[model samples]
Target: MIRPATPNDAPAAIQLLFLAMEDIARKISGTNDMQVVTHIFEHLFREPGNQYSFENTLLYDAGNGVAGMIVGYDGGKLHQLRKPVLDYIRWQTGAGVCPEDETQAGEFYLDSIAVAPGNQGKGIGGQLIDAAVARAAGEGMRKAGLLVSTDNPAAQRLYERMGFKVEYTMPFAGGRYHHLIKKIDNA
Candidate 1:
């Protein structure tokens, strides 16, 4: 069962999100401190307008609890909610990290997707990707995009199989990432 994430899902969603983007999180926070990162994530995930807010997340539930999650947002509106989130991160981490140039304009940006460690290989990740794309199309977006680390060949392959083509390579989160985009067919 895939559903929109609720405030109550913050803990679970944060866990998976941190698991998936630990390196990126650390880069932004300027600390490898798990506690600080977790604190920042908790605040961000519970807040209303930020990129990682519950409003922008979806959870895959497999009976017991949240088994997976996908976080994304409209690229055009990406900066509208930036100040508050950045303020919160700075307050919590004492590091003012600027947003990376990750998504192209007018696209739906898939920020992060992760299944619980034990839940991988069960198709939850793919389902979440499909759901994210469908959500983008439903919102009238013309394309969907995401970044895959250059070293993460498995994920890059998955995106390729889903019809995403690498549009360019961008430096992000202390490493190079392939920015992939897929046209969203509304029909």
Candidate 2:
């Protein structure tokens, strides 16, 4: 069952996010230490309206615990909470990490999606993507977007199958990423 993430899901959600985006998290935190990353995530998860907040996450609970989660927000509003997030990271990690230019204006950005390694290949990722897109459309967004690392062709193909097309390519986290977008037909 997929549902909105609650504060109680913070630990699991953060773990899933770290698993999916550990490279980026490590880059941002300036340390590969997950304890530092978890500290940063814990701060952001409790703060409403920020990118990593629980308010912006949706979880897939597969009977036992959180099997997966998707985090997203409006592209235009993305910067509203940037300063605080960066400040928190800087304070904790001793240096601030540069934010990646991942989303475009006027789109609902699907920030991160991750399924437990043991639970993958079971269509949980696709369900999370579909649910995120539907939530974006329901919020009256015209498009939905996400970044797929160039190294991950399987993920890219999954996005392609879901009707997303490459809008552009950009350098991110010392690697190239394809920014994919899908038009959300709210009607």
Candidate 3:
């Protein structure tokens, strides 16, 4: 079943977030220590309005644990949503980042998504994307967008299969990325 994530999902969700984040997690944490990154993000995850908060997350719970997650929000709110995270990073790591805009007006951005390694090949990812799409449509979004690393062809193929088309290529998080979008409304 898919449901909005909550504080209780932090531990599991952070692991999944870190898995999806990969190198970005290290950048955000300002360190390569897995424990420190997890600790920092888990703290942010439990908060309510930040970009990494539970307010922006949904997960698949298969009666036992969180198998996957989709974290996203309105592109127009990117700055508002990211402020808390930036503040938290400064407070916790004493460092800062000037992340390039990976999203913009007129879409609901899918910030991150990952399925637990144990749950791979189970079709859970598609279901999660479907859920996010439905939510975006219900919220009156014109489109849904996400950034995929250009080097990750397999992931790009999955997004293509799900109706996303490359709108452009740009630099983000220290690599080239394809910014893909799929219309979610008639407009």
Candidate 4:
């Protein structure tokens, strides 16, 4: 079942974020950087007013004992000038891996959408994305956007199939990693 996440869901959301990040990092860097990344992601994405605001969603797979989550941000005009520069510094410092870009196609931002490894390939991800878009549209957003790691083509293809188009790609300091964005119209 898909549901809107409340503040009470923070703990579970943090836990899930940790699990998802560890899984991805193991696949990508294979280092012990997951904890650091997860902590930063949780703080920046969930802790509103620090720099931005987000509307997060959670999916419960009662029958399969799994849960999925989607985190979306408002991306107000303030972010255009502030966030990209901040992200650039963070990326340079090896504190994070996000592209510094300004998106005008959407008022809402889907930061990260993750499904438990054990329950992947069951369409839970699509459901979560759909729900998030609906919520954003309901809130008067004309479009939605998200970023995916460029190395993860499987996820990029999935987003493309869902009508997301790549907007930009920025290489990490190592030049081996990149972040890609896809913009979707709610209308």
Candidate number achieving the greatest lDDT relative to the actual structure: 3
Which parts of model 3 have CA positions greater than 4 angstroms off? Answer: none
Measure candidate 3: CA RMSD.
1.1
Residues 95-155, model 4: lDDT tens digits: 4334344344445666557777777898888998888788777777877776666668898
Q: Over all chains combined, what TM-score does candidate 3 have?
A: 0.97
Total backbone clashes of candidate 2, pairs 3 or more residues apart or in separate chains? 0
C-alpha local distance difference test of each model: 0.88, 0.88, 0.90, 0.58
Over 1-187, each residue of candidate 2 has an lDDT whose tens digit, in order, gives: 9999888888899999987788888887888888888889977887887889999999999989999999988888877756677788888888767767788678999999999999999999999999999999888999999999999999999999999999999998788999999999872
Report the poorest 10 consecutive residues by lDDT, candidate 2: 78-87
Model 2, runs deviating above 4 Å: none
What digit string (tens of lDDT, one per residue) describes model 1 on residues 16-90?
A: 998789877887777889898888888888889888899999999999999999998998877775667778878
**Model 4 off-target regions past 4 Å?**
19-55, 61-66, 77-105, 172-186
Residue 122's lDDT in candidate 4 = 86
Per-candidate TM-scores read 0.96, 0.96, 0.97, 0.64
Output candidate 2 Cα RMSD: 1.1
Please write out the lDDT profile of model 3 over residues 1-187, one tens digit for every residue: 9999999899999989877886897886677888877888999999988889999999999889999999989999999998888888889888657578999988899999999999988999999998988888888898999999999999999999999999999999798999999998543
What's the residue-level lDDT of 57 in candidate 4? 51
Off by over 4 Å in 1: none
